[model samples]
Target: MAEVSLQNLEKVYPNGFQAIYDLNLDIANGEFLVLVGPSGCGKSTALRMVAGLETITSGTLTIAGEPMNDVEPKDRNVAMVFQNYALYPHLDVARNIGFALRLSGMPKAEIETKVGEAARILELESLLHNKPAQLSGGQRQRVAMGRAIVRDPAVFLMDEPLSNLDAKLRVQMRAEIARLHRRLAATTLYVTHDQVEAMTMGDRVAVIRDGVLQQTDEPSALYDSPDNVFVAGFIGAPAMNLRRGHLRSVDGDWTIQLGHNRLPLADSVLTERPALAGYDGAELVVGIRPEAMEDASLSDNNAPRIVVDAELTEALGSDMLVHFYLDAAAVDTGDPDVLDDLEDAALMIARVDPRSPVRSGSRIELTVDTKRFHFFDPKTNLAIRS
Candidate 1:
């Protein structure tokens, strides 16, 4: 295992197209760090730069405390597992796993031993004689991993390795890979556009947008405390509900006016975010996670409530997602993936108990978890943090 460092790494194309800005990140030895963003966010470009597949226009690349800027990819001692499961169709699983050892001119018995170990680790021992065409998608993916394992690389670079599988298979492969990482304890840099995948697998996740780094933290931290409106809206499932609101002081208490309703802020909210004091009587962005609101009748929370007519309701077994229209303007997240939802600020979603009698066109009251509310500046879209 090795520590990977990228200091002010940059990538610029010949046509003057810059794909990555000054990205500074350090991956500790044996840590799993995931790079995540929407398509075309330059995440793949950044990963390619580290693998020496693309040139770094500036900055430094180091692995295990050694400069790797001018090192050849073959000499970098890093193994990559691609999304396509790049295995030779004609070769059996064992041969494909041992191919790298053969290339290095290792003894035949040693190559067989290494291949055997990799197969056992990947649970591909029974399929050693099978070709890629004969194996299932998940099995083929394991074979690809086995090939990487046999080499015992200092670092592993996986680029959406599970993306091509079916949804069920993807979920299974996700667990498999996570288990593999824990067992090997190899330093891994994984790139994916799937937020759930990143959250579930990465020890730390780095979110990027438009060639610039946005935030890097543990998955829960990124979700609970985002740095800006983009991250506030992008990190959560169903995304966060960001709407324009007026924050003002009413009788020494703070309240946010969202169109027709005013939700009082809890005292803890201000105590945690002292910076919000400066936004009193100002228009700012308010972010509410879907789970932050619940059916008032089913909730014991003493938080403020907002009444709205349910536009749609999705029964998702464990909980019901109630979609309603808030008479406020929705803030754009600056993410192309969610442009449709942000086009109108009126759309708001609340995750409520499945027993709640919320249906299309039905009136419902949602209890807002005011203390958990996220406030951001309207001008800069940055969170109001102390």
Candidate 2:
């Protein structure tokens, strides 16, 4: 296995459209790093650059301490699994898996041995004789993975390999891929637009936007301490609820003004975020994840709680998603890709237990985990605290 590193990587097309900008990242040997973002966010472009499928406009890419700017894709010793199962229609599963070895002129016995091992690992031993046309979508994807596995390349580049499968199969394949990574321990760079996949499959995730690198870190760290408004709003499942509010000192206590409501800031919050002092009299964006808020009836006195009017209610089996509105200005970060399908109505969703009897249009009390509240500067859109 080999480590991959990109330093100041950039990709500018002939038409003057910049696809990537000043991107720098390093994937350790045997590490699984996921590149995740919205569509047209330069994720796939960056992956292609590393795979030698696209040219690098201005940057250096190194694999195992050697520069690979002019190396051919095959000579780079990398295996790529595309979204579509690129299998030969005429070949059966066994022949398809061992096709690379066959082209390299390996003995038939060695090819069969390697193909058998790969099929056993992918649980495709029973379907080794089926053709691509006869296999299920999931089975076809496994065949594609088996083909890559038989190559035994130093690095594996997968671009949304699970997008074509159904939801249930996607989840199943997700676990299978994770298990396969553990068994092979090959350095991998996976690109996908799904945040859920990124969170679950990656040892580390890099979030990109508008052809720019926003943040790269552990999945939980990115969720708990986002570096900017874009990341804070993008990483979570229900997405973060951002509202414009003013920070002020009321009777020697720092509090945030949400329209007519004033929520006092905890002492720990002020101590951790010294930058918040500068916005004492100015507006800032306050972010809270849906899972961080709970029904007041189920909360203790030590937690920070807020009262709001519920606008809508969704009864998910395990939990309830409560939507509420406040009289704050709508949040618009100016990124059309991020804001395109967003709701015009400013709403907050609270994930509460199904046991809670809160209803729509009711004045409900919600508790905010004050320790987890995030503050972002409106001008820079970056988090006040690290």
Candidate 3:
């Protein structure tokens, strides 16, 4: 296993299209790092650069403290698992897994031993003799992974490897891959557009947007304390609710004015966020997570509360997602990448208990965990309260 580091990495095409801009990141040895963003956000390009498949326009890339800018892909000692599971239809599973070793003229006995071990680990021992035509989609993907595992490379690069699988199989393979990482402890850099996969699979996640590195941190930290508006809205399931509101000082108390309602700020919120005190009478973007907003019955009165008419309700077995709109003008946090979606713009979802009796068009009181509220500067879109 080896640590991968990128210092001021950049990728500019001859046609003048810039795919990545000053991307600086470090993947620790044996760490599973995920690079996630929306489509065409330069995630795959970054991974390809690290794999030595794309030439760097500027900056340096180091693997295990060695400069690899001029290294060939084959000499980089990296294994890549592609999304399409590029397996040969004519080759059986055993031969497919040992193809790399075979090309290197490894002994037949050693090739068989390594292939057998990888097959057993992936639970494909029974299908070793079957060709790609005989295997299921999931099985073929496993074969691709088996091929990578046999190489024992310094780094593992997986580019949307689970995109072809069905939903159920995708979840299953996610767990399996996590287990494989724990067992092998291989340095891995996974690229995907799926935020859920980024959150659940990676030990650390780097969020990119418009070819720019926005934020990189652990899943929980990224979700809980996003560095900017784009990250705050992109990392969560229902995403964070962001609306434009003015902070006003009324009778020595700081309160937020939203439409016709005013919600008082908690003492803890002001105590922890001193910068918020300066924003009095200033417009700011307020972010509230679905989990942070609860039904009136589940609300603790000490926290800030907002009462709105439920626009829609979706009962997803595990929890209820209550969607509603506020009367206030929506904040233009300047993160076009996140707020560009109309569906996310018109509605704010609150995760509630399945047993909650809230329904569409009904007036429901929701509490915003004041301590968890995320404040962002309306102009810069950067989080004000860390």
Query: Which candidate number has the best lDDT?
Result: 1
Q: Write the per-residue lDDT of candidate 2 for residues 91-166, one digit (tens) a residue.
A: 9999999999999999999999999999999999999999999999999999999999999999999999999999
Give per-candidate clash totals: 1, 0, 0
Off by over 4 Å in 1: 341-346
Whole-model lDDT per candidate: 0.91, 0.89, 0.90
TM-score, ranked from best to worst: 1, 3, 2
Structural RMSD, model 3 = 1.5
The CA-based lDDT of model 1 is what? 0.91
lDDT of 3 at 137: 90
The TM-score obtained by model 1 is: 0.97
